[model samples]
Target: MALEAIKNQETLAVLGKKFDVSPIVISKWKLELLDKLPGIFDRTGSASDESETVDTEKLYAQIGGAESGE
Candidate 1:
């Protein structure tokens, strides 16, 4: 629906009627989607950088096990 709104594929009134939501609510959803789109595509991976840690040793062990099927 938000994509439809962004593409102007249909009027808000039509979308609202089809989805059983108010036109204003649809507009808000469209705005919210627009506002977050940039972050969604952020390639820096900053969103999860703080909470994630790569265990190189564990990864290497897994790779070795997979190669040997053990």
Candidate 2:
């Protein structure tokens, strides 16, 4: 709905009705989406980056125990 509003694919009134929300709400959502869109794509400290710091040896030990029914 917010994307539609941003793209002008449909009027706020039309999108609001289709999504069962008010036009004002859709407008706010559109603005919020635009405001946060940049952060969503920022990869500096993203989950994938943090995942690289995980202790894989610890994880493998846990998995090995589980496989042996210990």
Candidate 3:
């Protein structure tokens, strides 16, 4: 709703009044939404590709198998 209001050329002060929030807050929200808008339809799938799977059991076994040099 705030985004829509912004798009309609409403002043930041007016939007702030309507939403009962500071103009700075509305401005920050608008900026954040704009910054992230492109990721919503990203076709390269980079977001999912960056994730790594971890094996906790393998890690535990390695830790338990290690001998203390003391």
Candidate 4:
């Protein structure tokens, strides 16, 4: 709602009053929302790729250790 109000060019003080929050809080929320907007439509999909694989063998080699099955 705050985001919509901000988009409609409402003053920060008005938004704060409508939402019962401080103007600074409204501004901070607006900034955070805008900062994360691009990630909502991200198509690179790196998060899935990172979670799909775990190269434990390579990790052990890098740290000069062997995978000891205990």
Error of 2 at 39 (Å): 2.2
Query: Residues 1-70, candidate 4, lDDT per residue (tens digit)?
Result: 4475559678877775676556665576678788778776775756676544868886445334311211
- Model 4: per-residue Cα lDDT at residue 25: 55
* Candidate 3 structure quality by residue, lDDT tens digits, 1-70: 4475559688877776676556665676678788878776765666567555768897455434432210
| lDDT agreement with native, every candidate | 0.73, 0.73, 0.62, 0.61
Spell out the clash pairs found in candidate 3: none
Please provide, for model 1 over 1-70, each residue's C-alpha lDDT reduced to its tens digit, 9 standing for 90 to 100: 7888999989988887786666766687799899889877665656567555878897566445544542
Q: What are the runs in model 4 whose C-alpha is more than 4 Å off? A: 43-70
Error of 1 at 18 (Å): 0.9
A best-first ranking of the candidates according to their lDDT comes to: 1, 2, 3, 4
| Candidate 1 global lDDT | 0.73
| Regions of candidate 2 where Cα sits further than 4 Å from its true position | 46-70
TM-score of each: 0.57, 0.57, 0.53, 0.52
The digit string of per-residue lDDT tens for model 2 on 1-70 reads 7899999978988886686666776687789899889977776764766644768797566445544542
